[model samples]
Target: MNWRNFLAPYAQVVEELKVKLKGMRSQFEYESSHSPIEFVTARVKPVSSIKEKMKRKNIHMDNIEELQDIAGVRVVCQFVDDIYDIVDRLKSRNDFEVIEERDYINHKKESGYRSYHLIISYPVETIHGERKIIAEIQIRTLAMNFWATNEHSLNYKYEGRMPEKVRTRLKRAAEAAFKLDEEMAKVKDEIQEAQRIFKTNKESDD
Candidate 1:
């Protein structure tokens, strides 16, 4: 089948999934921000080209109706614990079926990275009919995402094979980013505690 013919239907499904996920994320942010939990931002990306390449390789994208992970959503959180909390809430939704999950935090990547990924099947009713589409959800802290982005860019520039010096530099950067994440987490807790104390003092004075 031609690329256009193969992708048209899937593209529509992906767009619908993006809209739904965005709406869900907005609701989540609103509800969580009021509490001690920090709000997170969601990003959606379509992997149609990657799926097409898999087809060329004769890899049967699981559930042809739901070509695995053609659409992706990334939820970036502030703290490590928040990542798990958000994933739990998302998994609890009846509209989504978690197909697979990977926790890269506890087990860091060789490149010294961490993130959580969830491959989920989300049902969307389109003009064609009800279609279950795969959406990969990635959850990570801001620091982790920053490190990953830099490493990804460098890897792409070097076509996955970089000079030893550049590789070492990236490794150093990753370590620095890890430390930065820890420090930021500590600062965040301190600020939250101060805010609570201020609120308590104001209430007492009143």
Candidate 2:
């Protein structure tokens, strides 16, 4: 199987989703309002990782569409409220259909992972024709992103055989991250105002 050929469409989905999500942020900025999306990042899963996932899940290459995160996009926000705001916006969009949503923020995973996941069926126009592919959009606060990033690195390091003590420490860190997010939420209005003023000055200077 040609990995490059197989992954081209997933790559396109990531690129397109990044542009559209960034456009949402730009629109909010243009209107001089708080954009729920602070920043967006996206990627197509690497072939090696995909192969590992297939092996772990007993998935076949022919049924790759079952892997919802082949094309992944992350929307990071300043506040927890911003996450739900962005979710609503994504749900209302016409370009892609949201097939499912998992609200991990309210019901976090046992690993203390907290992110709102949206499974979207994205349509991409390829040279052959239009292809609809399953993709994942993850929305989370900056605090959550930081914790999750480190947790991911640790998971990679441990190779899914993390010691009980290390897992306990991670769970404690996750709670601390949530507390930070909660504290930030209390001052969210002030932060947004300061950012708005800074943006205005930057635009004037430009």
Candidate 3:
């Protein structure tokens, strides 16, 4: 199969979603409000990883469309509440239909993975017509993102068969991260106020 041709639409979905999400952040900045979206990033899964996942999941090449994460968008926010706020916004968007949702924050994985996952069906205009594809969006706080990033790296290093001790340590780290987020939430209002003041001062200085 033509991998590039097949992945083209997924790439378009990632780019379009990134632009729209970043635009949301821009809008919050313009209003001088705390943006639930601290940042937006997106990517189309690579051919190698796609093939690996398909083989692992027993998915046929003909059913490649069944893989929801071929296109991924990650929105990192400041606090846990911000994650839910972003999820609500994403659910309300008309550009894409939210087909599934997994609240990993409230129901974390056994490996201590915590993120709110949304599977969305997005339509991309092609030369022939519009084609709908499934994409995954992950919303998580900064602490969650940091811990998850490290856990991902460790998982890659261990090839998913992590040592028992390493797994235990990771779980502990995840808890610590969540605790940090909780503490930050307690002072969220103060933090936002200070940030707004700093931003205002910076703008005046320029």
Write one digit per residue (lDDT tens) for candidate 3, span 31-109: 8568888888899999998998999899998898889999999999999999998889889989989999999999999
Residue 26 CA error for candidate 1 (Å)? 3.6
Q: Which stretches of candidate 2 lie over 4 Å from their true place?
A: 204-206
What digit string (tens of lDDT, one per residue) describes model 1 on residues 70-97? 5556677777777888788778888779
Q: Worst lDDT window (10 residues) for model 2?
A: 29-38
Residue clash pairs of candidate 2: none
lDDT of 2 by residue, 1-206 (tens): 99899899999999999999999899988885688888999999988889999999999878877888999999999899999889998999899999999999999999999999999999999999999999999999999999999999999999989999999999999999999999999998999899889888998999
lDDT of 2 at 112: 92
Clashes of each: 0, 0, 0
On the 0 to 100 scale, the lDDT of residue 202 in model 2 is 91
Candidate 3 ranges beyond 4 A from true positions: none
Which residue pairs in candidate 1 have backbone atoms (N, alpha carbon, C) closer than 3 angstroms, thus clashing? none
Worst ten-residue run, lDDT, model 3?
32-41
Question: With candidate 3 superimposed using the best TM-score fit, by how many Å does residue 65's alpha carbon deviate from the native?
Answer: 1.3
